[model samples]
Target: MSRGKHARRRANRNRATLEGEVAALTAQLVRERKRLDQARAGARRADTAQARLTAETAAAARVMAPVEAEATQTAAAVGPACTVLTEAARELARCDARLSRAAGRSADPARLRTALNTGVRAHLDSVHRSAPLEYHHAAFRRRRGVDTPLCRTLNVGGWIPPEIAGTDHDRIAAHMASRAGEHTRAALWCWAVPPWMGLPDGTDAPGRRTALGATTTGAPDLPDGEFGGRLRAGAVVGTPWRHRPLVALPEDAVDLAYWYRRSAWTQNWHPHTRPVPFWLGDEHAHGFPRSQPLPPGTDRRLPFPAVIVVFESGWQLPARHPDPPDTRAPTGLLYARGHGPTTPPLEQPLYRLAPGTRRDELATPLELVDRYGATVEGLIFTADPDGHPTDEFAWCLAIHHPWGLPLGRITIPASRRATHWTTAIDNTLAGVCLAHFHPTATSTGSPGADPSSANAEPHARDDADVHVLDIAATSPTTGSHRTPAHAAGRAAHLRRATWRYQPVGPGRQHRRWTWVRATIVGGRASSRSTVYRLTDT
Candidate 1:
C-alpha cells in the first residue's frame, strides 16, 4: 500500500515537467514564423526593385532608338553635302575675288560695266576660236562670198516665216541645207534661240535695226566622202559639247550624208534632245540605224582603234563658271554635258576593225587632234577585242588636246592628288599614268608571274627587276586574262623604230619629246613597243 502511493506522486511530478517543455517549444515555433514573415517581405521588396530597374532600362533604350537612327541618317548625308558646300564656297570666293579685281580696275560704274562686258565678249570670242570647226564656224559666223536663203532672208530684214522655219526637226534641217552657204549658220541661228537669247537682240552703236540685216557668212562645202575630216574606219571624232567621242565607222557616202544632214539640223544646245545618235541603241535597230552592220558572211573582225581614256568617274572640278571659256579645262570636259551629274548614255558608240585589216596595223602612227587646232602624234590604240566599259574609256580618252599637254599625269591646282592619266599605253596603263615621274621603259616578266609584281615595273628599275606586263592588264578596257597569247607574241615581234618631231616654224622654239619604251615578254615571245612619245611643245 505505501509503494503504490509513492509511484502516483512520481508520475504527477513527471507530468508537470512535460507541460513546461511543451510551453518552451510553442514559444520557439512563434519566433520562427516571425522570421519567415520578415524574409518574405524582403524578397517582395527585392522583386519590385528588380522590375523597376528592368522598366527603366527598357525606357532608356526606347529614348535612344530615334537618336541612334538620327545619328545614322546625319552621317549618311554629311559626305555629299560637305562636298557641295565646299564647291559652293570655292565658287563664292572666286566671284568675290573677281569682283574685287574689277572694282580696283575701274572706279566709274559705267566704265566697270563696259569693262566687264568687253571682257566677257573677248572671252566668248576666245572660246569660239577654240571650239571644234563645226561649232566654231557656226558660233563665229565664218564669212563666205555666197549666201543661202536663210542668210539672205535674214540680211534683207525678212524674218523666217513659221512655214519656212518649219516645226519638224527634220524639215528645219532640210531648209537649212536648201541654201548653199547658210547650212551651218542656219543651224547656229536655231541653236541661238533657246540657249543664246542675245543673238537676235544685237544692235549697232547707231541704235539702228540693221543688225538683223547682217548675215553670218559660211565656209566652203565639205569635201565629198568626208564628214568630220574623212571619217576613218576606226578613228574617233570629238565634239565641243560632249565628253565622249564618236566611233568612226566604215560608212558609205549615203550614210555620211545622212549623218551630216541630221547633225547640221539638230541644235545640240537643247537640253532634252540627244543631238546626234553617234552611239548604237534600240533606236538604231527599230527607228534609225547609226551605222550599217557588217554582212553576215564576213570574217570575224577585231575591236576598232580608239583612244581609251581613263579617269575617276567621281572626279569633279571644284568650281565651274557657265561661260564657254570654262570648257577649256580637261576637268571641265567632265561637265561638258551640263551642271547635272553625268552618266554613260544608253547607246555608247563602238568601233571595230575591218576583218580585212591586219592585226599588226593596230600600232599605225596616228594623231590626237582637237577642235582647238592642237595635234599630238602617237600610235592608235584599239578597243578591247572582247568588250570594254565603253563609257569609262570614252570619258577617259576624251580629254580634249586643246586643254593642256603632258597628258599622262595631270595634277590640278589646289588639288591634293593628281586626278588624270591620259596615255596611249595598252591595257597595262594604270597607276603608272598617274605616277609623278615618267618611266623611261616598261617590261612584263611572264604570264604566270604574280600580279602584285605588275605594279613593280612603273616604280622599279627595269634592270633590277622583271615585272609582268599583262599583255592585257586589268583596266576599264578588258578583263585581266582576255588578251590572246598570240597578241603578246605579236608584240614580241615589233621592230624598233623612231621618228623625229617636226618643228612648227623657224622662229618657234623646238619642243622636246618624251618617250616610254615598253618590252612585253610573253611565252616564247618578246617585243618592244613605244607606248607613249609625247612632245613638250
Candidate 2:
C-alpha cells in the first residue's frame, strides 16, 4: 500500500512540470504577434509621409514655373529698350562734343535770330500770296472781257426793270437770277477767256462791268436820224436798252456741272453717270460695259481696265403753246434756248476737223479729229448715239501719260448761240491718271529718284531677296509679296554679301541650329516670314 502511494506522487510532479512549459510558450507567441502588428502600422506611416512630401514638392514647382516665365519675358523686353537707351546716350554725347567743337565758330545769337525771323516772314508772305481767294470775280471778268450773266444778275444793282428801259426783259432777268441762285452757290469760281470775246490788253480784271451803249460808242455811232429818228418820230415812244454782256464760265465748271447734273438726274434718265453695273459684282468692272463678259481665269491678282460708257439726260421742250401771243415766241425764249434773236433755231451740231489740226483756235459746232494722230489707237466715242437715255460722250485717249501730262484742250464759245453746248469732264480722271502714271513697280523701273547710297543698299538687298522666293507658297505664310525660293535666295545673298556672324563654340564649331531674324534698316520686320532661317550654322 505504501509503494502505490509513492508512484502516484511521482506522476503528479511530472504533470505539473509539463503544464508550466505550455504556459511559457503561449506568452512568447502572443508577444511575437503584437510586434508584427506594430511593424505594419509603422510601415504605413512611413508611406504616408513620403507621399505628402511628393505632393508638396509638386505644388511648389507649379507656383515657381510662371514666375520664371515672367522673369524671362521681362528680361527680353528690357534688353531692346536698354540697347536703345544706350545708343541714345552715345548719340547725345557725340552731339555735345560736336557743339563744344563748334562753339568757337558759332554765329552770333542775335544774327541767327534775325535770320530765322526773316526766313519765317518770307515763308508767311509766300503762303499769303499763293492763298486762294473767296471772291475771284475780278480775275474772271478781266480774262473773259465781261461779267458772266449769272454774276451780273447776282450783284446788288444788276437787276433792271423793263419799265425803266424799253424792253420786255424782267422775265428773262428774273429767270436767270433764279437759275444762278440754285446752281452757283457751291460753284468754284475761276477765270476763263471766252473764245468769242477776245480779251483786251491790260484788261485782266474779272469783276469789271461796262454799259453796252458805252462799249459800242467807240464803234461806228448809229445815225441819230435812223432808228433813233424813228423813235423820235414816235414809232417807238420809249427809250431802248442795250443787249446784256456775256462772259465765260471757268474750266472746272465742267466737273461741277457733271456732279450736279448726275445728282439731279435719275439713273434711267442719266445712265452715263450711274454706278456701273456688273453681273459678277467685281469691283474691277467699274467703268466697263455691263454686256462685256470678264476674261476667263482672271482672279483678283489681275485688275480690269476702265472702259468708256455713255448715258442720257432727260430734258424735253414744251409740246404746245398756250395762245396766239405765246406762239409768237415767249419773251426771253432766246436766252433760255442759249441763242440770240438773230441766231437760227437751236440744233445739235457736228463738225469734223482735219487730222492733226491744232485745236488752239476752234469755234462752236466744231470737232477736231486725230488730235493725237495714230497715238489715239483706242479712240472710243461712246455716247447716246441713238438718242437713248444713255446720252454721254466717253473719249478715252489711247496714249498713257503721267498724271501731269495734259490730255486734251476744250474751248468755251462766248457767243450766246452756243451757250447750251457746254462740255463736261470726268473728275475720276484724277484717280485714273494717277493709276496709269504710277504703274506697278514690276512693269516700271525703280520709282522716284535714286535714293542715297547709304539708304539704297538695304532696300536693294531686300527687294532682291523677295524676288528669289517661290511667290505662291511663301507669300501666303510670310505675308510677303515674294515667293519662298526668292526669299531664301535673298536671305543667302544678304548673309553672304552684307552681314557676318561669329561662332559661339570652340574650334570653329557651328551651332547645330541657328536662327536668323532680319529687319530693314531703320524699319521693323513687317512679317514673321522675314525670319530668314532656323538652320545649322
Report the number of the highest-lDDT candidate: 1
Model 2 CA lDDT for position 435: 19
Candidates' lDDT values, in order?
0.29, 0.27
TM-score of 1: 0.18
Question: 32, model 2: CA deviation in Å?
Answer: 64
Kindly list the per-residue Cα lDDT of model 2 for residues 1-537, writing each as its tens digit. Answer: 889998988888888887888788888889888898898899899999999999868755654567779889989999999999999889777755544443336667665456545432212232244556523555657677876445211211111211333344554334223321122211111001111211222222111101000111111111212110011111110110111112211221222222222222211122232221111111111211211222233221101221221111111111111223434222221222232212211111001122232222231111111111101111111223332222222221111112112122211112112222111122112112111111112212245533323566432321101011121221112343333444553332212111123354588776221112232332233322111111111
Give the CA lDDT, 0 to 100, for residue 140 in model 2. Answer: 58
| TM-scores for every candidate against the unseen true structure | 0.18, 0.17
Task: List residue ranges in candidate 1 displaced over 4 A.
Answer: 1-185, 188-240, 245-533
lDDT of 1 by residue, 30-116 (tens): 999999999999999999999999996875575567778988998898979999999988977776666566667446787558657
- Model 1: colliding residue pairs: 304-352, 309-396, 309-397, 310-396, 444-469, 445-467, 445-468, 492-526, 492-527
Q: Which stretches of candidate 2 lie over 4 Å from their true place?
A: 1-168, 175-293, 296-478, 483-537
